[model samples]
Target: MRLSRYFLPVLKETPAEAQIVSHRYMLRAGMIKQASAGIYSWLPLGFKVLRKLENIVHEEQVRAGHIPMLMPTLQSADLWRESGRYDGYGEEMLRMQDRHGRDMLFSPTAEEMFTDVFRSHVKSYKDLPLTLYQIQWKFRDEIRPRFGVMRGREFLMKDGYNFDQSKEDALHAYNRHLVSYLRTYERMGLQAIPMRADSGPIGGDYTHEFLVLAETGESEVFYDSEITDLKFGDREIDFDSVEQCQAVLEEFTSRYARTDETHDEAVFNALPEERRRVARGIEVGQIFYFGTQYSEALGATVQTPDGTSVPVHMGSHGIGVSRLLGAIIEASHDDKGIIWPEGVTPFHCGIVNLKQGDEAADGACEALYGSLTALGLEPLYDDRNERAGGKFATMDLIGLPWRITVGPRGLKNGVVELTCRRTGESEELPPEQAVAKVAEIYAGI
Candidate 1:
């Protein structure tokens, strides 16, 4: 991707409405533009990152033995009515009438719709352990939608629903989701602590919200300090093994962690004083184990071998796909801009021609770009006829994980500078070696 041809409309002055770091940077970087009070238009760069996050979510879910499918953004109000939640869901749901005067809603959640599909087709316990998910746009008319994508009225989300024949099986599905979510967040360079949280309108007695701690986060959280050291790095997982998934669930949740919604002051105080820590966190995902909550309401029952019909146990899990970008930026950015983790960066590497239009500098950058692209890597080349400082600033603002700096002086010395965005460190090496280094770093990711 060449900067000269790209549609990145970066702003020099920060927008006044951006009250948080994520919002400020997102606006100034030209990743998003306000479409309404709480909605946004994801620009090309923003859209690219959004899609990257969506893909990661899909990969993790599928790896956990969940099936992927698409659901409509608009659904019939009849499903909600059938579940006895149409009136109970309140104003956050954007309710309206179609041309035929039928009640409709922009889907805030798909629990009811999924249950309807289940009851209509799945009649036997044979399909009991099925888990289906979709990455789709959702709307939840926030009363005061602030904070860019973090608390937007409209956003993208990965919502999954599981149906099992028994309570035990549903709980295992819940554990599976927790295991997958840990790996998913870790891959994006985030440490999202799984904290006990109130289910809210989702309605589950068992739930955990994954939170990435940041000073600017919206949720006030109390947790054990030791939880910070836990990492799910490169560990092999057997998603189909119930025992393996349950072990992971117990290991990660053994420590004390809870959000403000479910805070137990007495329990928190019982821990050693030194081990307790209180801070803010941005929620990125959640898992629930509500046995028969939606299934019972929507008549989603399956037949057992003994010829008995029973409501299937069910649970819903969600990852705020679009909101994750804000959370990542809040947790990873520095004064310069967002420092995208290699796993989720829109572009793998950036090519900067310090002396653009100079024959040697141009040739070196072009060669680097070609080599990276040929290797199935996306490298954003700052090919515009701009000053070195401006080009460098843009690279820093956009935050590709690695960058190659090509100039007449460096090229004359038979090398180019490879810089890491997170470390802000640079080393000069031959062009091929620099490309190899970047590729090596991402290959591991």
Candidate 2:
């Protein structure tokens, strides 16, 4: 992508309305624009990152054996009424009426809709232990939505529903999702600690919110530092073997961790002083094991082998896909701008033509850009006739992992300077060697 041809509308001065670092930087970087109080139109650069996140989440969920399905953004209110939550869900529900005067709503969550789908077709234990998911937009009327996409009223969410024939089966499915969530966040270069949390209106005795610690986070969280060092890759997971996944889940959950909603002060105080960590947390994902909550209320029952009918035990898992874009910046940005993780960055390399009109400089940058793209890399070439400082600042603000500079002097010497945005390190290399070096740095192998 060429800068002159790109739609990146970067701002020079920070917006006054942005209270937090991510919120301010997002505006200044022009990644998103406010469509309303809490709604936003994701610009080109922002949409690229959001789509990458959704793909990662989708891959991880599929690896955990959950099938993908698309659910509607607008759903019939009858489903919620059937589940006995129409009145109980409160103001966040976004209630409305259609032209026919029938009740409708932009679903804040899809627990009821999934239950209805299950009751309509799945009639036996044969279809038990099914897990389905969707990546879609959701609406919630936040009284005070702030901090950019971090707390937006309209946002994208990756939500999954699990149905099992018994409580034991449902627990196993829930634990599988917990393992998947940890893997997903880690792949995106985020440390997410699973902490016990309140079910809220979702209504479940068993719930866990995966939190990424940041100063601007919305929830207060307490945990053991050891949780940060733990790695899921260290363990061998046999997905077919439920016990293997169960053991991994237990190892992580055994540590002390909880959000303010479910904090047990006595238990927290008993921890060794050095291991204790109290910080603000941004919720990236949440999972719940609600046994028969939706099934019983909505008559979602299946046949048993003993010729009896039984309510299906169910659970729901959610990842705030759009919110993660802001949450990651909140945790990783520096004074210059966002320090995007390589996995989620819109492009891996920013190729700057420091002297665009100069034939030699332009030739070197164009050659390097072509080579990088051919090697399966996404490179942003600044072909605009701009000053070197402005080019550098624009690249830094967007936070591509690497910057390759082709200036008149460097081009004369048959060399280009490769800059590491995260480390602020640079070294000169021949144009032929630039692609391989950038690939190595991106892989970090």
Candidate 3:
């Protein structure tokens, strides 16, 4: 991608309305545009990163054996009515009457819809442990939607529903999702702690919110420091062995962690001072074991081995896909712009043609761009006639993990400079060696 051909409408000054660093930087970098008060149109660059995040979520969900199929954004009110939540869901629910004067809604969540689907197809215990998910847009009608995409009324989310025949089996499904969530955040370069959470509108007794700690976060959370350092790589996933999956979850859950709603003063007091951490955190993902909540209401029953029909025990897991873009920026970024994690970065490397019109600079940049593309690295070539400082600023603002400067001096001398955006370390290497070095560095990141 060339900067001259890109649709990045970067601003010279911060927008006055952006309250947080992530929100402000997102606007200044031209990543998104506000389509309305609580909605946004994701610009090209923003959409690229959003797709990467969604794919990572998809991969992790698939690894946990959850199949994907999309559901509609609008749903019939009769589905909600079966759950007795048509009236109970309150104003956040975007309820309306259709042309036929029948009630409908822009779905805030998909429990009732999934329930209806489950009951329609699977009739026996053999289809008991099924997990289905989708990555789609949802509308909530937030009264005071602010903070850019972080709390937008319309956003992208990955929500999964699990159906099982018994509470114990449903819990096994929940623990698989728990492990999957840990791996999902880990892949995105985030340390998300699973804390007990209030069920809220998604009614359930057992709920866990995967939160990433950031200074600008909305929720107050306390956790043992070790929880942040816990590595998912330490254990292997045995999805078929329910007990083993439960053990892995118990190992991580044993470390003290709780959101404000479930925080225990005694537990906090007992922790050694150095081991404790209290901070604000963003809720990036949430999982709940709502035993028969939607299934019972919607009559999603499966026949048991003894030929008795019972409502399938159920759970739902959600990842705030668009909100994570903001959360990633909040956790990262310095005085410059976003410092994107390599896994979710829109481009792998950015090639700055510091002297765009100069033949040597242009030639070297085009060659390097071709080389990067051949190596499966997406490199943005700043072939626009711009000052070195402006090109550098744009590259930093877009926040590719690696940067290569093809300046007049370097091109003339047969050496190009490769810089690590995160570390600000630069090394001058012959043009022939730059591609291999970048491939090696990015492979490590």
Give the top-scoring candidate (lDDT): 1
lDDT of 1 by residue, 1-445 (tens): 9989999999988999999989999998889999999999999999999998888899899999999988999999998988899999999999999999999999999998888888999999987699999999999999999999999999999999999999889899999999999999998889999999998888887999999999999999999999999999889999889999988998899999999999999999999999999999999999998888888888999999999999999999999999999999999988999999988999999999888779888888888989999988999999988898998898999889888998888888999999999999999999999988888887877
- Alpha-carbon runs more than 4 Å astray in model 1: none
Off by over 4 Å in 2: 234-236, 442-445
Per-prediction count of colliding residue pairs? 0, 0, 0
Better of 1 and 2 by lDDT: 1
State residue 138's C-alpha deviation in candidate 3, in Å.
Answer: 0.5
Model 2: per-residue Cα lDDT over 136-245, one tens digit each = 99999999999999998999999999999989889889889988998899878898899999998898989999999999889999998888888876344666577977
lDDT of 3 by residue, 180-292 (tens): 89888888988888998899888788989999899999999999998877888645687778887888789779888999999998989799999989999999999999998
Best by TM-score: 1
Cα lDDT, model 1, residue 88? 95
Q: How close is every model to the real structure, measured as TM-score?
A: 0.98, 0.98, 0.98
TM-score of 2: 0.98
The 10-residue segment with the lowest total lDDT in model 1: 436-445
Error of 3 at 239 (Å): 2.3
